[model samples]
Target: MSPNLLLADESTGSKLRRNLLAVAGTLLLMTTYTVLVITQPTDLTGGLGQGVALATFAAYLLSALLLLAAVLRDLPVSTLTLIPVALGLNILLGQFVGSVMVPLYLDSIGTVLVGFLAGRRAGAATGVLGTLIWSLFAPTVLPFAAGAALIGFLAGTAARFGAVRRVYLAPIAGLVSGVLVGTISAPVAAFVFGGTSGVGTGAVVAAFRSMGDSLLSAVTKQALISDPGDKAIVFLIAAMLVYALPSRMYQSYEFVRRYRVLGNLSGERD
Candidate 1:
């Protein structure tokens, strides 16, 4: 066997250490940013500022890229290449969805794809890091990175449980993930954007406000209406994509099993 294929190779161990260090550093940087915002709320309270922003642009940009790099560091060469494609798809789709007057976010397709094909760790990394990258230009997404990470983690986990293998259960996974995201996003929307997302849902929030619903209630309602259906579709799409992948692709991924959409269950690949 090639030295590279040996799990105990010293070079591989060193690479793992380096990646772990990077993750630690990234976390520290993000924690520092959070603390600064909390301790000195006025400085970084708002994502964008013309003067004296809470944190420097360099800090935000660096943390995002570093986390992304760390997440992709351990993947096989072929699988690693897909990360960029996924990120691009997500960003473009997310932007389009944001621009349109719709409450649904179809932006998680990339995250879901990677999550199902990889595993929870990689999936969560993709979600959190992808949202961080998006935050560079769209600061609003930063607060929801946690939600993204959770959804990705869950999607990958569902695959391990054979949900994706069964077409009927895939939508259930999506709906479950969406509800989880809504729980996290509600507070973020309420406090960060004050229940307005500049979309069709925003209008619903406005109506709720006029009807004397609390900001939290309005945002939560909007999420209830929009997130489940949108996330169900995202999961369904991801399942379909997984079904289309060749068997070789599954071999490259540690968490993904031999998946055949229509084949009888022969159990997971070793």
Candidate 2:
């Protein structure tokens, strides 16, 4: 009957709702990721040697589980973004390019982004944990993964210090991260799979060769290359979707932050 008692009851209900939503969202992500991994096209490809194929499959499964755990733990956004991007890159490269470039998508960019937002210690820890996990199952990805982690840490640290906000700096960060991801992945592939030269020579050479061939063919065909057009279109559609959506979710996030719901709930429990 007291006002304070009524407030307490309402807070308890809010806490329960938040927890339930979080749990439900995590379960959905886990199920979707699991199905995606199982049905991935690469799993059917016969190019990878049997040993490599099996190892890769297991690694992917574990990575999916790890990503799911990260989501459940409410890991930083940068870290969360890494999962879909990594998976997308993997699928794209595997289907269009080749497995030789698999390591390039080891979630370095996302880690770096997270570090930038959260600070060095958290960023570095995320990188280190990601690297260790990738190494355990895909040792061939170690060099690239390590390079990605380091780049992420540096980028994050620099962002924290306000060095990352400059327009020029952002592209530089992306370039450095991409190069590191590509370079590191190449050597690891050579070492773990054998019969390949280090990343410096082989991977770079292959990339250049591929670029040259594509450019020549495109020129010969008189195809005007508008690289940003497709990307712009995609982004426009995404923006429209976000704009069209109701703002309830955004409002809810603001409400929680404004009210410090998590803090309040914990204090109540204590």
Candidate 3:
């Protein structure tokens, strides 16, 4: 059990209640937004296009901030400090990779890294917040915040299950995560954006469409083709980064210590 969870004081109960509320609220908001986009794409993009986008941005930001607040209480100050760097890394690499010739999007490396070191809540917060920040330059990404959050959540879950213990396991976990993410995000891309988000992914979708696939079908097929590879690469990179960290540094995280996330690397020197 986590030492933090062992606290029995009234304050701990209060904190727990508030944390649950925050997490629930974040999930509600993100889920509501995703549903709204999937069900009423025209409503969101019709007369109130920019306004709706701004509203979504605000809602997503609030969800992310609430999740971050809950995570802040659980994670150490040192671990919390890495979030901005991670967010920046997501945006920089996401944009750079999206614009390149590669079909993969390597945006969540930092989020996955945090998940490997911290836990799911922190990683999910990082993913949603990073996507929100990235949306500042690209408004189209606003609708996909839920998907981003899922990546981080999955990454943390993967780490908690010892996916990072072996280098090969990371990509395998990512491959599975990619299929799930792709299915979840396909509806949004198809309904809201006509099944194309980037040039490479768009090309894949177009190829699938040319083969007589419906809009959603083409997008799903494209996502399955691209997302698994993208996430596999992302997870492999994240696992490599975690392995590169000095044992002492990563060991400082309570999540790592409690879960033995690194799988008995005590003999390794800092």
Candidate 4:
């Protein structure tokens, strides 16, 4: 949070119209591509195939966008800006993780960031939106939308429990998030992606499989191995960001009022 987190909405009606128009345009584009896919044969690498892929991608991304539009169109303009930045960060960081083949999927950092700063609905929107946006580049990411949403929702729940306010409790939030996300993601990995996490964490699953463990077990073990500590880092980072926010920004949101990091109201800068 920064003092600049919530810029007042001067032209609320105009902003709403713009948002709706964007949604409409995206839907039209998706429908056009979808119809092309239906009328044309699937080409694994041809133009029509690309159109099919584009249509599917657009549809998936559109769902997330519509959800955000429906639930978060009323958010502060600054927050709307923050969301794009967070989504980009999530994708960039996720790519970095994939390149290194790290066991962790810290991509949900953006989702957690939004939830911590703006509460659950904002957080959920960020998670879903970020994941869908990420999928545009890496279709393999399409299956993990639920896991991303899990991180955002749990991060908000943790904040509500005063985890973000107290430094000591922050790691607890991460640990809890890790456990839940890992459990939730394991099945997705096993079924949707065939236990191949498309990251270095696949090495962990392979090792388990070599030991004669089942695919689901291997994936679950892999998640358990990496998710808890990974999510803990994510939570700690979000808490730190909150701590670094300016007083006005920190205190502006109603959901975070229960936390006492700022001590006294008079202590904040005017």
Against the true structure, whose TM-score is highest? 3
Ordered list by TM-score, greatest first? 3, 1, 4, 2
Tell me the lDDT of candidate 1: 0.69
Better of 3 and 4 by TM-score: 3
lDDT of 4 by residue, 31-79 (tens): 5434533453324346754555555445544544554565566666656
Kindly list the per-residue Cα lDDT of model 2 for residues 1-270, writing each as its tens digit.
668555333366555665565355335434533443344322223555444445534443343333333333444444455444433433343344335653222234445434444444344445545655656766655433333444444545555444443334444444444443333333223223332334533444455446763322222222111212222222222223323434453223332223322233211222
Rank order (by lDDT, best first): 3, 1, 4, 2
> Worst ten-residue run, lDDT, model 2?
219-228
lDDT of each model, Cα atoms only? 0.69, 0.39, 0.77, 0.68
RMSD of each: 5.8, 15.4, 5.4, 8.8
lDDT of 3 at 212: 82
What clash pairs does model 1 have? 43-54, 44-54
Candidate 1 has what TM-score? 0.69
Residue runs of model 3 more than 4 Å from their true location after superposition:
1-75, 95-101, 266-270
Model 3 residue 133 distance off true place after TM-score fit, in angstroms? 0.9
- Which predicted model would earn the best lDDT? 3
> How many clashes does each candidate structure show, in the order listed?
2, 1, 0, 0
Question: Weakest 10 consecutive residues, lDDT, candidate 3?
Answer: 36-45
TM-scores, one per candidate: 0.69, 0.34, 0.77, 0.67
User: How many times do residue backbones clash in model 4?
Assistant: 0
